[model samples]
Target: MAVKKIGIIMNGVTGRMGTNQHLVRSIVAIRQQGGVVLSNGDLIMPDPILVGRNEDKLQALAEKHGIERWSTNLEQCLADPHNVIYFDSQTTVRRAEAIRKAIKAGKHIYCEKPTATSLEESLELAQLAYEAGVKTGVVQDKLFLPGLLKLKRLIDSGFFGKILSVRMEFGYWVFEGDWQAGQRPSWNYRKEDGGGIIVDMFAHWRYVLDNLFGNVKSVSCLGVTHIPKRLDEQGHPYACTADDAAYATFELEGDIVVQANSSWAVRVNREDLLTIQVDGTEGSAVAGLRDCKVQHRVNTPKPVWNPDIENPFNFSEQWQTVPDNQNFDNGFKVQWELFLKHVVTDEPFIWNLLEGAKGTQLAELAIQSWDERRWIAVPELSLGVKQSDAVEASK
Candidate 1:
C-alpha cells in the first residue's frame, strides 16, 4: 500500500516548542524514518505547512527544514482541502480564535495545553470541535517521562499500598531573557499575555495528578509575584505583571492531599527539575524527572530526640534507588507519535480538548482560589452531549 500523506497546517512553527519539538524532532524525524508504519503495513506521512504571522521567520524555518510549504495566512491554508490537520503551539491568548477558525474550515485539531486563556474559552473550543465533528487533542506529555512512567508502574503494582499524601517541588531560576538570556519566553511573566506560574504549571499538575495519583477534588492556593520587575526579550526593563510563584494544595476525592510548589524565581537545589514525593501506609517513594527511589516498611528507620540534646533522624538513608527497567522517548515526541497514530488510525485518544479544558479549569480555579482566599471545587467538564454518545451516534 502507498503512504497516505496527511497534510498538517502547523501554526506557530517559528516559536520555541514549534521549532524544536513539533517540526524538527517529530515531523522531520518521522519523515527521515520513512514515515509512520501502520499495523496494516501502510505508512502515514505528515506533510507539514509552516503557518504563522511572521513571514520572514516562517520562510527561514521552512528553508531550515527543507519544507516547501510556508504561509503567514492561516485561513488560506485552512481552506485548502488537503490540509486535514490543524496543529497549534501559539500563545494561550491566540489558541481559541485560531482553533475556531480551523474548525470552521472543518479540520481536525491538536494543540498545546491550557487550550485558551480562560476556562470558559477552553470549554467553548472543546464543544465547538465536537459540534464540528473534528478530532481534537491536547498535549499531555508528562505521562511519557521515563521516571514518571516508572512511578506509574510502581503505583499500578501497589508498591505503595493505601496511599497517604504526595508532595511535589518543581522549579528553576529562570534568568530574565533580557540581561541573562533566560530559558523561557519573556511574555511568560506578563498577565496580559496569559503568563503566570500557576496557570502554566497547574495545568500540568491537573493531568499528572489524575493520571498518576487520583482525581483532584478541590484546591487552595496562594500565588505571588516574587519578582516585580524583569527584563524582556530585548535588553530593557519591564514590570512583571504576573505571579512568579505558587504554593497550592489539592484535596483528592479519597482523602488524599497533594501539595505542590511551582516557581520561576527559586534557585535550584533539588533532586531534579521536578520531584514528587509519595507516602503510603506500606511504603514511600520519591520520583524525580529521571530517577525514582523507594522506601519500604522493612527498611523503616527510627530516631529519638531529647530536650537537652540534638535529634538525629537519618531516614533519608533508608531509601533505595529504583532500577530503570525500560527506556522511554522524549515526552513531547512520545505524545506526537500518539497524535499521529490517532490521526491515521482513528484510535481513541482520551487526552482531547475536553481534557485540556479540565486542566484549564484547574488553572483558572487555582487563580480564583488565590484571589478569593478560599478553596475552589472544579466543576465537571461537559462536552455538549457526552463524547462517547456523540462518537457512537456518528458511527
Candidate 2:
C-alpha cells in the first residue's frame, strides 16, 4: 500500500485554538489513530511541521508533541517541496499575507476561518488558489459537532417538519483584561488586530445557517463594544476598538429568518456558550454545544394567556432532551478526519476557500451595513479583478 507523505505546515500553534483544536485534538489525534486509512488500504500520514515566530514556544510545543520539525521561517518552510499543505491559524490580519504566500508556493491550504480581515483579500486568496489549481478549505468545525449533528439528523428525519426560524444565543462573560485575566487573547479586543465578535462568530453562523436552515440572502446587524477599554496581556489598559457584541438577523432565501446574538461580555445563563433553537411549523429543536432537545407541537405546552400578573411562559417543560446516539461525538476530531480523507482521496469537501470567502464577504458586508445603517447587497464572487474575465474563465 502506498503511503502519501503529506507535510502540513501549521502556523499559530502558540495560540489557544491552534494548540487545542488543530494540534492536540486534530493532528495529534490523527497520529494516535495510526494515520488515516483509505478504502484501498493506502495511508495518509500528516508529517506536520510546526511554524511560528517564537522559537522557544515552537521548540516547547514540538518537544511536548514529539514532533520532529519546528521552524520560525515560514518562507523557508513553504520553499520546501515536502510541505504540500500550508495551514494558518494566525491573527486574522496576518492570515491574508501568509495564505497568499502559501498559494503562490503551490501548497494546498487548510486554514481557520474568516480567511481574511477584508472580503477583498479573502476573494483574492480564493481566486489565486483557484487559478493556481491547489486544493483549499476552511475549518467549518461546528457542522461536525456532536450536538449539531444530532440536530441535523433530527431535521433530516423529518422530526422538524418545515423549518420556520432559527434563534442562536452565543456568548460568555469575557473578563475585563484590566482587573482580571481574560479567557481570550488581548488582540481579540482591538479592531486593528482584527478583533471583533462579528467577524469571529458570523463566519461560523453563515455556514451553520446555510447548512441547517437556508441560504442567507440578506442581513441587518447592530454591533457594540460594551467594554470600551480592557487590559492587555501585560496588564496595561488598552482601548477596545473592536465590537464585543453583535446582534444580527438574516433573511434567508426561503424567507426563513435566522437571528443570532454573539458577545464576549454576556453572562452565561443558557445551556452552553452556543445554543441554537430551531422552530419549525410542526416541531422545534434546541441544540447546545454538547446536547440537543426536541419538542413537537403535540408535546408543546398548552398555556393560557394571562398578562395581568406574572404570566411567564414555562417553555422548558414542553421540550424533551434528545437521546444520545452512537455517533454523538467529538467535533474537531471528526472534521480533522474528514479533512484527512479529503486530502488523501480528493473527496468532495464543500467547505473550500470559496465557501470561506463567502462567509468573509457576508461578515464584511454586515459590518458595512451596520456602519452605513443600510442593507448591503452581497456581491457575487468575481474570480478576477474584472467580472467579465472571471465569468469567461469560470466557464
Candidate 3:
C-alpha cells in the first residue's frame, strides 16, 4: 500500500492525439483508477504537468482535467528534478529536438513514433539515451489493440498453422476542407512539416509486422500525392507536397509476404478504418480494430472460377467470429500503464528507442524505395554502432 507519485512532464499535449490518447484516456484514466498497482503492492501514480506553447490552452486543459500543475515553459518544467519522465506528442519535425533536450535534462523519454525524420537522427537519439542510461520508449499502440491481440493469441495457439501472408487495408476519405474541414491536421499533407502517409504509417507497420509475424527483410513501395490541392485550417487553399497515399509490399524473415495499402483519399468499404487479413496453410483470419473473424482450412468452401455462370457461394458466411473472451482496455491506456510500471519498478520494457529507430529506418527506406523504384533491404539496426558504421553495415 505504498503510493509513489511519479511526476511526468507532458509536452505538446494540447494537440489532438496528445490530449485525447496520452492525457485523457491514459494518464487521467489511470489516476481515476487509483494508479497502477505493482506486484510488490506499491501504487505508482502519474502526476502530469501539462506543458504547451500556449498558456491559455495549457491552463484550460489543466483546469478541465482537475490537474494541479500546468506550464507554458518547457525548460522550466524540465529543470525540476521531481519530473522524472518527459513525454512528447508534438509535430514530427519538432520531436527529435525536444526529446534531445529532455534526455540532456536527465529524464526518461516516451513519445509517439517515427521518433525522428531520418534514420541517422533516430539512431543517434537511441545511442544518446543508451549512453545516458535513461529509460526510453515509443508508442506502438496498435500492438495492444483487441483485434491484433486476438490475432496474436491465434498465432500463439497455432490457429493459423504455417503462417503465409498478410494483407492490410487501412484508410478513410478525409474531407478537403473546402466544404468540410479535414479530419486530420493541415500539416499532415505538407512535406516541409514532416508530414506524409508513408512516414506516419510505415512506422506502425514495421513494428506490427516485426512483432506479429516476422522481421521485415525488404520492402517495395509506391507513393502518391493523390489530393494535390487542399484547404488549410483557415479555409485557405494550399498545394500538398507530401504523399497522401502509399502502396507497399514487404518480405518477412519467414518468407512471408505483406502488402499494405494506406491512404487518406480512399473511402472506407471494409470492417473498420484498418483491417488486416492473414492467410496461412491451415487457416485465415481478417481482423479489424475490435473484431476478428477466422476460417480454418477445413471450414473453407471451394469456389471454382466461372466467367459465364452467376456465383452462388456465400463467401462471407464461411468465417466464424472470434469471441471476446477477455475484456480489453483502451490500447493507449494499456501501453501507458505498462510504461508507468516500467518507470517505477525496473520492469522489462522491450519497446525502447532502438525499436523506434528501426521504425524510422523502415519509413526512410520505404520512401527511398518508392523514389528509386526498387526494393530496399531492411538491415538490422545496432545501438552500439556509430552512424558511419551503421551506414557501412547496411551496405
**Clash counts for all predictions:** 0, 1, 0
Which residue segments of model 2 deviate by more than 4 Å? 307-314, 382-395
**Residues forming the 10-long window of minimal summed lDDT in candidate 2:** 386-395
Candidate 2 per-residue C-alpha lDDT over 1-395 given as tens digits, one digit per residue, 9 for 90 to 100? 98887899999988999999889888888887888888899888889999998999999999999899999999999999999899999988889999989999999899999999866677778889999999888999999877888899988898878888899999999999656799988888888889898899889998998888777888889999999988878988899999999988888877788889999999999879899999988899999987899888887877888789896787777678887767544577677667778776888788888889778878877897789887655545655576344323222
Comparing 1 and 2 on TM-score, the stronger one: 2
Best by TM-score: 3
Better candidate number, 2 or 3, judged by TM-score: 3
Taking the tens digit of each residue's C-alpha lDDT, what string does model 3 give over 104-216?
A: 99999999998999888998999999999999989999999999999999999999889899999999999999989899999999999999999999999999999999999
Model 2, C-alpha of 72: deviation from truth (Å): 0.8
**Model 1 residue 342 lDDT score:** 91
Ranking by lDDT: 3, 1, 2
TM values, all candidates: 0.93, 0.94, 0.98
Q: Please state the error at residue 292 of candidate 2 in Å.
A: 0.8
Rank by TM-score, descending? 3, 2, 1
